[model samples]
Target: MKRRRKKRSTKQYAVIAFYEKNNRWPAPSSQNVKERHLGEWITRCRFIRNHSPEKLTEKQIQLIDRIDADKAQKKTERWMVNYEMLKDFVEKEKRWPSVNASEPEEIRLVNWCLSQRITRKNTPKSKLNKEHIKLLDDIGFHWSSNNKRRTWKESFNLVKDYYARTGQWPAHTRDPEESRLAKWCSKMRAYKNRTDTSVTLSPGQIKKLSNLGFDWTNSQENNRRSPENTNRIWIERYHHFCEFTTNNKRYPKAKSGDPQEESLYSWWMRMAYLKRKGKLSNERIHLLDCIGFRWGKGNE
Candidate 1:
């Protein structure tokens, strides 16, 4: 008797192997569940199914779905690269923005301004505010902050520093009242000889004389001298002459057994003679002829 052919369980074996590899069963509703197995398993299963595959196991389909879902989630959650961070890395490594050495002086200055760490307001107008002005002034920078046009404080500081380092004040500061007074005193002392010359008026005396319109000049010849004015001028000149002689260590000689005390007019006449003869310079002449100096000779 002919024995009945046994049916091969290749599909069942394939499903088992697929479940073992994936740790999960294929989906029950998938049409290609059987084909989702490993190559050896798929070949055996295809041969078993008469080379006409049907649905795959639910476990295989489920495994594939899980893998696909995991891949999609990973793609969605991938770490992104920050452009700024990349730029920073490139700059540090390659010096991306090239630094020019000597473009223009002005450009460099502008760049310096831009690159400066701005802790305070750098605008000229902002820096010239009342508070900053006071601060700068307290630090010895005397300047005017007006109209927003210039940096007077900076210029003042530069000038002050230059003077301090050089021991010379600016031209504008050299003509102070004290300096002028000192110059005048020196000139008067230099010409105290060669003629009857004297300085009766101190700075205070001169100031008083100026106020009284008694500052005699060649141009003041039009003003005729009154007796009182002449007497006062002579007295002042006499005092100046006494002071000059005392300072110069000059002793007056006596004539005819009497002390040769010169009068103001006599001293003035002698000085005028010396000046006309070109024996005296203008400064000496001026000192000798001054109203106070002329009168001072007699007292000496």
Candidate 2:
């Protein structure tokens, strides 16, 4: 007689075969899929379908349901917190959520509100209202009270631009020393206008005048009368001696024994007169005195 064969149980056919090959159970639901678990489940399914008898098991279905519940609960909690934070930030600040309070986006939003308020309250006409200037001064921005009306708008805009660019106000607008220098320069320029001459001299011109034995520290009229006038006299006397020597055909002597020498002797007398008047330079006077003694000795 033939004996009856026992049918294979589904768990023994499906799950036991999968576990023997892969060492993990199949996932119960799609929501239960995680990186490590999904990889294991896919590998096990392939192994079971290729080598084991194909069947669904009650135990495998219960395991998948448990994983799906856990995934749903975690996702719900994350969604609730994300939505609540977004809503609170937007409603309270009337802006989008910033990554942090000090982030550039939050600072930009604050700057935009300030700019909008300033724009809305700005007046186009040039009536002298000191409200904005006073407000800036109260916040420690300073300006001269005398010039405040003329510079109020400019000062206000400068402070606004400083804060907008750097996200902070400037500590000082102008240096005290720089203000003093500007005032001094203005006064000097005004004095130059009254004097009808430049107050400063070029270095080249100063060097050239020094070479010519001019003293600049003395007043202009005194300079003209002193070394300058004496030098002119010496030049004139030299020219006269040159003319006499050339016309007399002696070149370096006078027609009456020495015409050029006689002209030079006359020039020495003029230089002595200038020296007595405090007009001739010391070097020039010394040379003239030496030449005069020589001419007198020759005459004797």
Q: Best lDDT goes to which candidate?
A: 2
Per-residue lDDT of candidate 2, residues 1-300 (tens digit):
112111223323454455467665443222333422342343333323323323424444444344345556765575445445444556686765322244554444433433323333433335323554444344442232222232322332333343345332233213332243234333333443444354554566345434544333323233334343344444445445433433343223322333335446555455556766898677555443422322332343
Show model 1 residue runs off by greater than 4 Å: 1-219, 251-300
Q: How far in Å is the alpha carbon of 201 misplaced in model 1?
A: 32
Model 2 has a clash total of 6
Q: What count of clashes does model 1 give?
A: 17
Displacement of residue 38 (Cα, Å) in model 2 is 6.7
RMSD per candidate (Å) reads 50.9, 45.8
Q: What is the lDDT of residue 258 in candidate 2?
A: 32
TM-score of each: 0.16, 0.20
Residue range 1-300, candidate 1, lDDT tens digits: 112111224445555566688764443223353533333233333222322224444543444445446545654343112223324434465532222222333233322222221212323354434653454344343232122222323232333333333333322222232243333333333433223255343566445434433323323243335544443444345344444344334433433121123332345556556655876566444434432233234455
Alpha carbon lDDT at 68, candidate 2: 41
